[model samples]
Target: MQSLFERIDRLNGKYNALVSLDRPRALQRAREADLAQARGQSWGPLHGVPITVKDSFRTAGLRTTAGYAPLRDSVPDRDADAVARLKNAGAIVIGKSNCAPLCSDLQTRNDIFGTTGNPWEAGRTAGGSSGGEAAAVALGLSPLGLGSDSGGSIRVPASYCGVYGFKPSIGKIARDGLIPPLGDPAREDSLTVVGAIARSVRDLALSYSILSGEPYGIDAAPQHAPRIAWTGEFPRQLMDDEVSSALEAAYRTLSDSGASVEKVEPPLDLHFLNFKYFMLNMYEFSPRESSPGLHKLFWLFESARSVFSGGIEANYKKLKADQREQVDLFDRFAQQFDCWALPATPTAAFHHQKSGRPIPIRHRGKSKRYSYWHATGGFAFLANFLGCPSVAIPIGRDRNGLPIGIQVVGRREQDTALLRTAAHIAERIGSTMPLAT
Candidate 1:
């Protein structure tokens, strides 16, 4: 544990992966764990493992800002449910990792902490809002990290950093003490989920079981090969050659491994689903309070309903309806296939740029401006929208040597099954491809 801290101290400056360190307390806990072992007391599964939590999760006595300026010095009186679970399992919290501002942006950078860089490529983004967690684990700073996913936050970073990230079905893990708290209205949208990012699939399963208060055997692989469904493209989505090729290779490998592989088209229109997701996200992120004077002005602005799309309440209703339809479609599809495999992202990690600027990409032999979120979240948004479990695993690298990932998605509330499938795929892929060092 001490050696891990020393390595973090040495590499943090270059990666900017961690925002706050609780080294003294962590070392003290490590000593206590060692003494407990010496006394012949049964230690927990994590034992003395050192792990980092995303800045958005409130850690007791440790500053958690969620990349917001207002909470820069705010320390919580109690740890978030996930954090407490890891601690009870004997894992020592070493520090808080960087995240997107208010967990809103696609890239991890804010006024409180600077940008986190990709460990594989110096100038490229690490991916966010869980960018720090993924980069830290990929660089060997920590073996495991806890991150939150809302609209691809966990999967995108894991894909970019060449690590494993898993998002369980909604309500599987308790969501308490998370910053930018998901209050009643946000719950209606139901997009955010706390998840884990790790260097290995087994570590992901271990940490997930601990956090979710589930047992180890729940994620065990099936005795026989499982049926898998896959697709290389989605409606109105474009993929870089490298990403498309890696996904194809993964499908071929799974087929060769005795898994029943089938190519299938998604039931719903992806572009329309993405639109509903965007509307709901905007409504959830919208400010709730306003000054009296501004309130009247805002009311007048809202009164012009025809000019604007709709009110937040109306958008929420439409989002709920869309969600139900999408869920039903996925449920029917899941009845036939055990899991669906897709590209984690359309492109590999790109050069770091300021948020809100259009990123240029080559598609169909032409240059085009791509929204960062649209590029990373196109395939990922479906899982969150339908409230299903999804796992991202590193498949191989692109022509430029950047990592590419494939996501295995399962039916709602079938997180363990999803993890088991992910483990099988990871074993096959890891044997053939060398992961990012």
Candidate 2:
């Protein structure tokens, strides 16, 4: 049988999922893993696996781009803290996958890297900002890959591409080297997180535990069936009929499996949600510490608007105002539920060229323009805004036969519990995709 790295290379042209390939290094690690096994020394859980990473991750000596030109040539001397942990657990980094510009957009295409196409439909988008990583795993380009989710970057792509992606409870996985590195004493804090995208929930959990370096402890043992909250109608609007039906079916599957499942409509503040999202995200380009390129971008915004109009000041005010609401939302959700479940994206993968643009997702014959075509990530942003964890599981296919996914989010630091629940749900729903023939 061909080694995993070889298999990925063989499929590269067809999928166009990977932006770079480190064949020699991956083969070197494979040989080392085989030798260690022969010596009766178990390398680690992911030993010998050829894993890919979103270019946003800082892999020592590898081209790390959050899919931007300015940072393309900027190689880090150290592996991202998460990357370091994965390596310690014996997973070899085979290559850096593509991502959005500055990891900013929802689609993976950017001026730096062309685009990442879907495995299921080559002409459709693979999903973004972690689209490339999801595409790789979905196409079996790699057994697993690591990605970051700021606003559904991980889950959206996985949902569209029919793969597994998890945004572990905030701070569960060390975020020292994730792109747009935040929390630098000299820098402002933004709400971005590093997570994993894989073909199976087991792979997602395994990668998280490896990165966390936490003793399995209480979570090592199998978990009992969970009480799940499945929301069919989105907090903002009713979802597409086909998409909503898939989610409802998934809930029924869990119920039949003996897990208690409820359909609840939680109140949400859409404006506050969007405000906080834009604020925290845009805060990354803070004038005090941003690079010249970012500064120039901000300058254009300032110049475009009238000085008397409170141009940049309005943006700051909205951000600060939303921060308060952001805190309230987090506190309220912690009290009411163990986790919230909903569609990860409204629809499946669309045509490849249409990846990044916002499209009208029709629900009950009423069309509404969402944030992005995959904007059903309204469920995902809740987890991110609150610094919570969420896992996306493939539910079934949409009308087009592309994958449909649902996300289950949990309280902060409940990473393992959420993973366990998703695993149980996937088992009940029979959602795992068959290997591509």
- Model 2: lDDT equals 0.74
Q: Put down candidate 1 lDDT per residue, 131-191, tens digits, no spaces.
A: 9999998888888999998889999999988888999898888878876653555444478
Give the winner by lDDT: 1
Which run of 10 residues does model 1 get worst, by summed lDDT?
Answer: 285-294
Report the number of clashing residue pairs per model.
0, 2
Residues 207-305 of candidate 2: C-alpha lDDT, one tens digit per residue: 887888765433455544576776777454446667877877877878877877878766466445755665465554322333457556755765566
Error of 2 at 181 (Å): 4.3
**Global lDDT of each candidate:** 0.82, 0.74
TM-score of candidate 1 against the unseen true structure: 0.92
Cα lDDT for residue 422, candidate 2: 75
Clashing residue pairs in candidate 1 are none
- Candidate of highest TM-score: 1
